[model samples]
Target: MSKYIPGNQKHLTLVDRIYIENELNRGTTFKDIAKFLCKDPTTISKEVKAHRLSDWYHKGTFYNAKNFCIHRYHCKKTNACGKIILCGVKCTSCPTCNQTCRDFEKERCSRLDKAPYVCNGCPKKINHCTIAHKYSYNARFSNRKYRELLSDSRSGVNLTKHELHKKDRIISPLIEQGQSPYQIVTNHPELELSVRTVYTYLDQGLFTARNVDLKRKVKFKPRKCHKTQISDRTVFINRTYQDFQTLHLESFTEMDTVHSSRDSKKTLLTFFFTKEKLFLAFLMNRCTEGAVRLIFDRLEKRLGTYGFISTFEHILTDRGTEFGDPEALETGANGIQRTSIYYCDPMRSGQKGGLEQAHTMLRMVLPKGTRFEFLTQWDVNLIVNHINSMPRESLGGRTPYSVALETLGEEVLNAFQLRPIAPDEVNLTPKLIRFNS
Candidate 1:
């Protein structure tokens, strides 16, 4: 469906995402949304399915506890665990029975599996809806997910074999005719490649022309250290490390980003819940200010205004380019002040030493230079589950998940979908997630 898309089309902006969300809620068709957005129907279909999240309500009050078993309503069988005397409850009443019973089959709503692919536009009343899991397309979440995907897709070599061959046909001939790559690109601007990129392709042996062919290419050595200046000089008044020290806050969340390599666009936006000793990380394709804002939006959406404020009372982070916009991080989407953000002193990563220590454990699973391109949020969650499950000496041998549960409670933990893995089952190695790459 996307094969013949309009050539000049741009990505769906935040406004477009909001419009899609509103239309979805209004029971609009994918074809209609696609036509309105100037996108293919398949694109709309894929976006909705990819970014839709399960909606939640207070269990047993407005919504029933999530039970998806096909036999949940009619099953009269007791003691599916094979201990009829010991386990007196019916199998349907038991939470673990679904895992234990061999006859257990999941029941899902067909409407959710089809074209619309979410419960947002369903005709059935939300309360009366029998689907075990309810999913809806949220504008904010979808927008963030789309940004991450766009950034990911843009990373690495973007040209296909056909495109490369076509360009090579144009470039290789010019190089053979004693014209430099720069001259060739200058002569024919239709190639649409940078002179440095053409050189890179030659160096990588993708083009017929090699470094040997270019008279001066092989003479230069690659530089080791490239220094970058601090961007966006919006002086952080009263939000500095000194100011944070004056506050004398009891607990705060320390935030940082973990990179695979200096050149890799993929990064992990990490948060260390200091009080709970819990570490959470999200996979971001690009470490940009907009990406950081999206993450804040996601958290705000999950925890609400007061919950976010209370939880992330004070956030201490470094003055990286990605964290330039402090106001966006501190302010909620609904114009409510959510939390305070503080910047650490230059080169003082040890200020947030607890989070640095957490990074050590994170390195155990994803060693330095591990490409994060193949990892999804699910993979990140799996890694977090293992990292948080391990017993920490600082927490008096208690796992971070346990301490977090005690301090933050189950409701808050559910907001992040955090679950503790058994200590014995936890695997902190590259083997944990067998990457497709």
Candidate 2:
């Protein structure tokens, strides 16, 4: 039993033979074996487990060295299973002779192949027997329907670097600069990007919107008016002077009737001087001759007779009822006696370009459709002063007051002033009653 293996005797290493016998026959504990051999118990255990021979009565008998060595030799030579059956070599037999379980219906290896009844060695049974199951747990069998989506190439098909840069660099900046998405795409068709893609890129933070400070404010849609009902005002001055290049500083005020609300019947008369960039507002019960006259008189009073006569050269107006009697007010107001008046054409509100332009500044305080009833004369005056003090691009960024004083010459403008013209003072009385004959 001890001298069974030739290597152990011919090479009869005292250490190997004694170590094995002490470990197997003497039933030395692993700790003792480790202490005796000065080797790890794990190494010794692995060696014994590998060499041990199995028998029905003796469970993996290693006590008989010769039987153990002989069984090892037979196993190597015969390709035999260690667990033998009562009848023959196999303890469990497959229907197939190739040592593979077969599905008689599919006529294939039942464990490795999908068959009508047999599943991969898994007793729970699955629809398909995957190759990965035999070797590793990570493998899975995906049906064809789901394979295309899970593939690598199609994951980012919808986005690319070019698209990202265009969004960040081109589309976003242009939009920020006041260009719309449609404009961006239309302007550069070769960019190969859609308007929707530009939007998508913006959302993803690939590009930022450009900051645009618009020179002219946005215009809102005007109230619907029947074409036939509009006034037949003259637009010669506006059409003749399309823009500021052809405009003059004389009076040239933009006029509109400010209202209490969209539905308010009460309104105020407003005048925005284009050259001076001044806002002159007065409350008006209606856009009638009386209201217009009162506004003109108030303006003259504040501006002075000389300043009023010099500055009130032209009044640009829309054909609203309040401004319809512009000639009478221009003549009636003592200070504005020398002023001429102009009108915007029928339904062409934009033709009175001067005041229409200044409306942006005026709206800062007295906004469009603002009710005259709610605002006091003092509030209107404050708003007017604020606007007159504001710097305007038309006057080289100078305020209306600054530009007016510069144009009119300070001393002369100050000397020419508004005064209370009493009705008695307005008389044609002989300046000294020289009719003593």
Candidate 3:
């Protein structure tokens, strides 16, 4: 049963039909058909293959029902026979459990009878684990238990030998000086300990000193009723006597420095006579004691034997570094001896009232922190001369120069050979210099 090949349907030529039969049924090839029909072998083959029809074929097939009826359906992206029924139970592919019981894969259940209970064959081995199941299990498994065990297992809990030595070495001196914790730590950084440690040492009673202010480098607070602490220096004053009305001019003098803020390099050293209310101001190149000694020497040279013979009773001063050593101020080459020097109590400005008041007047020309490193000696002399010539209220509105002349007398005043003020330069018209005493 061979399949028939079709040639042309419309106006079929006899030769083409004969060629097809001979090529198909008679085992004659298309090359022989091409030679008989005078056509290409490919053209003869295509003509034979196309347009062939069965009595009842779909398009081009013989009437063999068994082979032609077979069918195949294909799907490129999906399976053609998909399952319709879906099982709602938990899947075995789930991480923790298979679909044995209702509970999904979560923490392992502790009950023994349940079929999906954690098994030994489970991958994560989650059986009988309480911490994973209950939030309340946290307290039983805390870090405090571990820490307590660790501490109990250790051998020591105290300072080392080196640490104790370092602590003792630094703390001993601070305690001996009676210094506060704040003071000790600030001054000695190597201590490397808290103020509470010092406080504990104090409570244990370690060390002591005499001057608390010096020990701590700080002053104590005054009581509400009193502004300052009472001093013991007044007892010494009793030994010297309080009868100032009878004392000689040579017994005492008040000393102070005055200068312009613009010209602090040149200071005017003022010495006021306590008994006669006379004043003298000298130009100074520096606030050094050397400069002070030089001025005293000049005064001695001008005043001759009287200046050399006069006793210098006492010098009162503030805590200036220039007067740090009183011996340097008193050491004159010829015949000058010792002079008693007194320091005014801290914060007690009234103790040096005369000098304090003079300083206030000086502040009008030279305010605080003025540098004495810029002025010439002649400039200081002119300013100091003017100040001495100014009238003072303590001397009944008389100029310091005039008061000196009246008290010491013209001859003694003339001994120094100070320049006399001309009539025009001298304003006898009095003006009182008022200041806080």
Q: Residue 435 in candidate 3 has what lDDT?
A: 20
In the range 42-89, model 2's lDDT, one tens digit per residue, is 544543443333222222333222231222222322213333344343
Consecutive 10-residue window with the lowest summed lDDT within model 1 = 56-65
Q: Between which residue pairs do clashes occur in model 1?
A: none
| Highest-lDDT candidate | 1
Off by over 4 Å in 3: 1-251, 258-267, 308-313, 336-340, 369-374, 411-437
Q: For each candidate, what TM-score against the reference?
A: 0.48, 0.36, 0.37
State each model's CA lDDT, in order: 0.83, 0.49, 0.48
Q: Pairs clashing in candidate 3? A: 264-372, 265-372, 265-373
For candidate 3, write residues 1-437 as lDDT tens digits.
11123332233354456445544444456677565665556655444434332222222222221221112111121211222245442223222221222333332344212311212223233333221322111112223443465588683424566775676677666656665668778887886767765555444444232234245433556435532232344423422223332343344666766654555566677765665554456767776767877876776666653454453456665544455555556555555554555555455556557666655555544456656564444433444345556666767876766767766667656654444454345332112112200
**Candidate 1 lDDT:** 0.83
Question: How does candidate 3 score on lDDT?
Answer: 0.48
- The residue-level lDDT of candidate 1 at 94 comes to 77
TM-score winner, 1 or 3: 1
How well does candidate 3 score on lDDT at residue 346?
Answer: 52
Off by over 4 Å in 1: 1-229, 435-437
Instruction: Using lDDT as the measure, name the better of candidate 1 and candidate 3.
Output: 1
The TM-score-based order of candidates, best leading, equals 1, 3, 2
Question: How well is each residue in 75-191 modelled by candidate 1, as lDDT tens digits?
Answer: 887887786677667778676766878888877777677978877777774556655567888999988888888899887678999999999999987787778987998989999
Q: What is the TM-score of candidate 3?
A: 0.37
